[model samples]
Target chain A: MLNTLFSGDFPRSRWLTGLLLLIAVALLLAPFLFPGSRPLDTAAKVCIFIVLVASYDLLLGYTGVVSFAHTVFFGMGAYGAAIALAKVGPGWGALLTGGALGVLSAMVLALLIALFSLRVRAIFFAMVTLAVASAFAILVSQLFHITGGEDGLSYSLPRELTPAFRLVQDKVFDVRIDGRLLTYYLVLTACAGLFLGLLRLVNSPFGRVLQAIRENEFRAEALGYRTVLYRTLASCIAAGVAALAGVMMAVWARYTGPETTLSMDIMVNILLMVVIGGMGTLYGAVVGATLFVLAQNYLQTLMAGLSSAVSGVPVLPNLFAPDRWLLWLGVLFILSVYFFPTGLVGRLRGTGSGR
Target chain B: MSGSFESLLARLRGGDGARRSGLLLIVALMLLALAGVGSLPTWITLTLAGLAMGMMVFIMASGLTLVFGLMDVLNFGHGAFISLGAFVGVSVMAALGPWMESASLAVNLAAVLAGAIIGMVVTGLFGYVFERLVVMPVYGNHLKQILITMGGLIVVEQLIYVVWGPDAIPIPRPETLKGALTFGDVVLEKYRLLAVAVGLVIFATMTAVLTRTKIGLLVRAGVENSEMVESLGYPVTRLFIAVFIAGSALAGLGGVMWGLYEEVITAHMGMSVMVMVFIVVIIGGLGSVEGCFLGALLVGLMNNYVAYLAPKMALGSSILLMVVILMWRPEGLLPVAKGR
Candidate 1:
């Protein structure tokens, strides 16, 4: 049953399997194990990013397509939910409606972009997407009446999902049984289901063709596969899943804005997580998201400590300033591309040179 | 002179008349704008503003296109150099505050020149290191090149934040260059005129180098087929490095101009302008200078006209132009035929 669940693609390396199990257990029991709002928030974010980055990997790693527009779809999903909830009033029905709206729009936009630009060279597609995504971001900001502009949209969730509503009359396992906890679990569950769906999609016969296309498009086409059709399909699927991740984010944060969802920084962060986790391996997304989120949360505190420790130094404090953490991550990203192009999961699984 | 002009036109048109069509498109766009705008002075001002903006974009994009042409290396981190150039140039201008503030045109010009030269030198040197460290390893692989260059971009941007702080620095234009040049009812900004002149000089010099020099021939040949050039005993690698440095230097010069034009400099400015730069590069064709120039002008003119006509639609004008142009000519307005 477990093998079937994973589509028979087990984490071949024992260490990898162990790490995956540990992450799963920790996330599953996050409320009980962590027992704090911040920790729980971090856990929830890890879940959303895992799905987001994995969906990206489906295109970048599995299909060998580099798209800068993934975040645009993510933004669409987020805005769709934000606007729907704001307009329709927050409820489970609203959530579902927003999510469906987000998913459909993302798919349509992705389809249009794929059909129009996918016929061109990969580099050309990357440029076109970058241009389009930036333009979309501008449009969103300009049409502030609908999107709340740069300030973003913040609205209430269903009563049961708000912190004011308690799930139980008393505390359970030293944790407050409030709507927040329920929402976390809801996000976690949705992410798990979405992630599993992606695993199933990538491991199917359709997935094998994507990998084949990634390896050699000419050969795949010569072998009678319509490469563009498959690529376009892969792009659409990735876009839809990315939108779903955005919906999950909206539910968790109860707010949506261009800064949080559509910014180029978020796009860069997604790229970093996907690359550092290991491309082509679904498990990498889980590991990457966990590591990146944890680092994002804790690394600043660590840097603050180091900065104070070297208070008297001339330039060292600035270098180790908490905000400069991305500099180190950038350096790490470059090094990984050169030395460990396969990423941490790839290394653990004993995958040789990167594909 | 007329005969020489005819010969130049013939050269630009080449065998396929790509450049001629690109030129005609630019004319058509202006005519459309003239009709829509109706007022000739407003049209002239908009056209001049558009041309100046186009010149600045061309300066930034020319090097990028050549680098892409010479080696299929699309440096996603090209914006890093642009930012670096702007920051460095601004710093130099700040240091030369006295000269910059002077009422004399020559002194103010000298200060700006100093900033541009120093900025170019620093960015050029950085580009060499960037080529060696960030770009050299990912040759021949498009995906890795994109990833690695992007990595370089992030690191450099963060480093800029660390060094310059996360504040937008205001740039003071020279005293003589601050006001507008009045041509009867049509007034043009003095800084923009300088920009146009600088852009024209760079464009002319670049054209001369590419067409009239031995290195230019080798670079052009290298872009078409580096291996063949190498087998013919030219050092293709050295040529590529030179092109990369030159490209970085030009981007730095553009950065300086862009900073003064905006009257402010920010690290993120490079990234923001990069969208326009990419549009221009793609519209012009990957490696063609003439194409890049025409593309930049088209985007710039379209941007001003659209913004003036409909502020809301202004955001998408360049992108709309790109899509339309791409639909018409998939390889761009003037594609440099590349040999694999």
Candidate 2:
């Protein structure tokens, strides 16, 4: 049953399995164990990002394609849900329809980009996607009537998912069983389910083909797999999953904007997570998202402490400033690319070289 | 001997027929824009603006194409050098504020020259270090190259923020280079004219060196087949380093020019301009200098004309141009000796 649950692809290492279990347990009881809005928000972000980063892994890790437009699909989904909710009101129908619209739009855009560029060299795809994604972002901001421009859109969810909605009259374990908790649980459940779905997809025969393409595209093509078709399909799947993640984010935050879902910084963060966690492994997304989101949320506070501590030193305080976190992350990203290449999951699994 | 020289020239030109066609495309685009606007003055003004923008883009893109042509390394971090150049140049000019603000043309020119020279030198040195530290480790691997360079870009951008305090620095044009030259209601910015002149000089000088000089021959030959050039006793590694530094210096010069043109410099400017550079390189074809030049001009003109005629389509015009060009010629307008 356990084997079937994991799609017969185990973590393959005891430490990895243990870490995964620990994360799972901590996440499952996050509200009860860590009773705070900030922690809950961070946890929710991690849950959402796991799916986002994992979907990216499907492209970069599995298919050997580095697309800068992952955020475009993500934005489409977020905007789709946000627009739908704003227009149709905050009911389940509006939410689901918006999410579906977002996913479908993302899939179509991904399909178009894939069909158009994947036929060329891999590098061309990267450049083209960057151009297209930036253009899309500018277009979104310009179309203020629909997208709310830079300020973004904010709307409430269904009453059952709002903070005002009370699930239980009294506090449970010193925590109000309100719609916030309900929304958090909903996001967690959806993320886990989506994550498993990605795992199952990757472990399947189709996924093996993607891995084969990543390992050697020419070899895969020579073996009669029709490389472009497979790559395009993989991109579509990744796009769909990414959009779903975007929808989840919209539902949680009750706000969607270019800065949140479509910014280059978010794109860079996604790349960092995928690389630092481990490319080509679904678990890498889980581990990377958790660690990165945690760092993102708390690293500034930690840096603030360090900055103040080193106030007497020249340059040290500036280097340790709260906003300078990306510098360290950037340094770590380069080191990971150079030293590990397979990320922490790969390191834990002893697959140091990735291949 | 003269026949051999002519053949060498021909070889350097790469594709004479394709080159003419690319130039014709530029002319055709201008004519098309003229037809759309119908006013000669507006068209000329737009054309001049487009040419100036094209030239600046070309200055920045030239180094990137040369680097890619000679060494199949796509340095995504090339933008860091641009940002660094802008910051350094602006700082130098800022320091020489009195000279920059002087009414005397010589003093104003001198200040600007100091900024340009120092900016180039600083970026040149930075490129050398960047080549050694960030780029040297990941050679011949496109995937790692992109990822690592992107990592370098992020780090350098963050460093710029740390150093410059994450604020946009605004710059005023040098006294002599400000304002416009009007030809009977056909007005042109003085700085834009200078940009065009500088771009042409660089292009002409590059052309002369590539066709007439031994080093240029070697660089061209190396682009075609580095191993052959290496076997022929030329240190390809040294050539690669030289090209990399020169390319970086040119990018710096472009950065200074761009910063002056925009009248503002931000840490993120490099990355933003990088998208345009990438588009230019792709449209010009990777590893092709002439192609890059033509591509930049085409994009510049397209952007200017579109922005004038249909404001809404301005953002998408260059991208749309890129898509159309790719469909027409997958290898770009003028692919180099061995297209990547």
> A172-231 in candidate 1: lDDT tens per residue?
878888999899998999899989999999899999999999999999999999999999
Clashing pairs in model 1, backbone N/Cα/C closer than 3 A: B284-B291
lDDT by residue (B223-248, candidate 1, tens digit) is 77899999999989999999999999
Model 2: residue B149 alpha-carbon error in angstroms: 0.6
Give the per-prediction TM-score of chain B. 0.96, 0.96
TM-score of chain B of 1: 0.96
The estimated TM-scores of all candidates read 0.97, 0.97
lDDT of 2 by residue, B265-331 (tens): 9999988898999899999988888899999999999999999999889759999888888887777
